[model samples]
Target: MGQLMGFLNIEKKNQKERDPRKRIGDWNEYREAMPEKEVREQAARCMDCGTPYCQIGTVLNKGTSGCPIHNLIPEWNDLVYRGLWREAYDRLAKTNNFPEFTSKACPAPCEGSCTAGFVSDPVSIKSIERSIIDRAFAEGWVVPKPPLRRTDKKIAVIGSGPAGMACADQLNKIGHNVTVFERSDRAGGLLMYGIPSMKIEKDVVDRRVHLLEAEGVVFKTGVDIGKDITEEEIRKDFDAVVLCTGAGKHRDVSIEGRDLEGISPAMEYLTASNRHLLYGEPLKPDFDAKGKRVIVIGGGDTGEDCVATAIRQGCKSVVQFGKHGRLPENRSESNPWPENPHVFSVDYAYEEAEELFGTDPREYYVETKKFTGDASGHVRSLLTGSFKSEAEEEKKWDADLVLIAIGFQGAEDRLFEDFGIEKDPSGRVIQADDRSYQTSSEGVFAAGDARRGATLIVWAIEEGRKAAAAVDLYLDRKLSLLQN
Candidate 1:
């Protein structure tokens, strides 16, 4: 702790966000920079706790907390505190392959469990991470450094989402030739498509992709293993195969008017915006919420993103429904210090809606029953419900566009059938031990979302690293096959 008493002494500071009124006119990112000096001062606030629970990254006792990747939080915190910006960046890159993504997108379970946060505000760990990584990139510190040795072995990874990218990057780092296959036109999967530029800029993703390409990872776009190329082809050519296909199959309300026009899943809506950025494609006509009274059902991160997107698109009004009750502002008696806190949070989308709509747009304790469409079958309104429990129900609301943000089922099943891979009953995830990350099929392994279902980007990176190690071992044991 360079400053020793810095947690108690310095006031907490975060980056400045864009002016709500002006930012809604376009899709640029909302956050502004904290001055470099101020960022260092904030970094000085980490307590460097002897036992940092922040890195534990999970919830326990219905309230477990800790970093899943077990990031070297304290080391980087000290490095930043000492004004070792480049050194801090190096320390960060040692564990996280893409701090820029997680710094912007993660929910920050690390902060919830921060030791200083028990009584005072937690150190802005995410902000510090972003600063270090951004500085590194500007300084040419981020470059292509290929592995020292080539295995003469190759791997095929399906899905260009975080999990697949993580697997491919790690495998390439360890001297294995890696080819990433993506069903979409571009390679980044969701980050390249599902997330809008307002949340994560497209150039940032492209820069990393460019770096990975320079580092010997091969990317093949517009290629679906089950369709364009057969699973048998992949099995025969590659030394090993890894599945990172995401759980992108949407979960719909499946009500009476679901098939009607103007009722859509959140991914469809967001993907349209991303595709436009990537290729300048015409917008997905079905999803424009402009000048309409929009209702988003489901109050998770996706719903918040929708509220923000709608506001930017000039929606007349927008409201989101939360089936769960509002969380408390602070931890309850049961939730003590150094734990992952799950109190209430107001994200960018909610704040943007508040600026335009004159109130928080979330309607808690509400549910949607069905869609009410006009005779021509475009959605005229939503058949709604208000429920405190399973037995209670109330219905109807006037809405022009209804976006269902209810989350996902699992990975698209075609990859499993194509690869003849096995999955657990929940449709989540193929079962694999933490160390090996292997699938039931021989010479095929799974990682990230395909192995663990939906999860954080940081976890996906860690899993990729572990799988790289496992693949290394798998290759060493089968050198005869590699000679072919």
Candidate 2:
């Protein structure tokens, strides 16, 4: 390493972020950029630990720390510090096809496992990562490298979400003619529509989509496989099929006045909000919170997002309900360091809500019982019951816009029957095998949330890449270079 004592010489610097007052008014990304020089200095902080567990990607400290996908963190960090931009990009692309996405949205488990964090702040891994990839795009280094030879085989990927996209990208690189079928008007299932623009910009997703298109991958939008096209046609036309649709069908609140016009699922609301941004118009079955009193019923990231969105829509007031009690401000014994802490997050959304409402809008240890709607069939307020782990029942709230933020059970499986594939009892499409992702029927494969249930985007990407590897092996036993 260039400077063994560099850690002591320079203090870590975080990226510049947007002003809380200004960013809260809209739904765009709030983080600002770090100066190039400052980011390189942060790179100097890596001590080059012997094991470098930050990149090894295994659980540490009892579900607290560790990276996933095992990035070559040190190698890229050194390259970035030396100003070897292209080399840094190459090192990054070795494992991750879309560092830009992870850099923006991922919570950065690698930093949690960082050894430098023991004494003070961890190295600016996420910031540096975003810098390298963004530079790669700017420098025009991210070109489409199509396979040298074409294979006679064809592959059909269901659900154009992250897993499907990753799988399609990898398989196409290995010479297969891959086609992605998305039911939506766009190709990127969640990435294109489900995720709000504030978190991940549309242009970034479009750029990747353009590259995939130029690389000869076919994206067929507005086509539902089980409905518009028959499964038999898909099965007969392609050598294999992969599923990457997300866990989107939400759990409904079965209670009095559920049919109230203003009560809606979190995804339905978020999806409409995103659609409005993309299409420059309103959506059918839209759930706009403008001038309404909003109460979001759930504690996770989804709930936080709703609060932010409500504020943007000019909701009069907003509150987020956490079914369980609040988490500790810092890591606890059960959720120790390096295992990814279950602590409070002052995310941009929360920051915005606090600035506008004059207080943090989160309400812990609460649950909703039902809604009371106006005579016009619109939500007026919520009747709620509170219980944390069945220990006690207390607390309630009055709400006008009742948003159910409970999690999803599985994929939109309306199309599952057409493929003749088996599904688990929970409605997750059954993969052909654990080691091999093929379905019960020959030439059909599954991956990502459609197969494994709803999960992180990183995990979806991993599932897509691994399934592609398996499918590539299945097609040509000759063994292409990088089978996972």
TM-score of each predicted structure versus truth: 0.96, 0.93
RMSD of each: 2.1, 3.1
Q: Write the per-residue lDDT of candidate 2 for residues 1-484, one digit (tens) a residue.
A: 5258666677877677788788767777878767788878888888777878677665455342455667889889888888888999999998888888888877787887777775667788899999999889889999988889998889999888888999999999988999999888887777777677777888889889889999999999999887798888897898888877777778878888999887889988888888888886765433778877789888877777788888888888998888787778876777655566577778877888888888888887776777777788877777767675555554445667878888888877667766677788776877556578877777778888888777667767878988999998788763353363
Query: Which candidate leads in lDDT?
Result: 1
lDDT of each: 0.81, 0.80
* Candidate 2 lDDT score relative to the true structure: 0.80
Q: Candidate 2 has which clashing residue pairs, if any?
A: 57-67, 63-339, 64-338, 64-339, 64-340, 65-338, 65-339, 432-438
lDDT, residue 302, candidate 2: 79
Question: Which run of 10 residues does model 2 get worst, by summed lDDT?
Answer: 58-67
For model 2, the superposed segments whose C-alpha errors exceed 4 Å read 2-10, 58-65, 283-286, 389-396, 431-434, 477-484
Q: What tens-digit string does per-residue lDDT give for candidate 1 at 306-387?
A: 8888887778899899888898997888767766776887878888888887899988888777777889988888766667
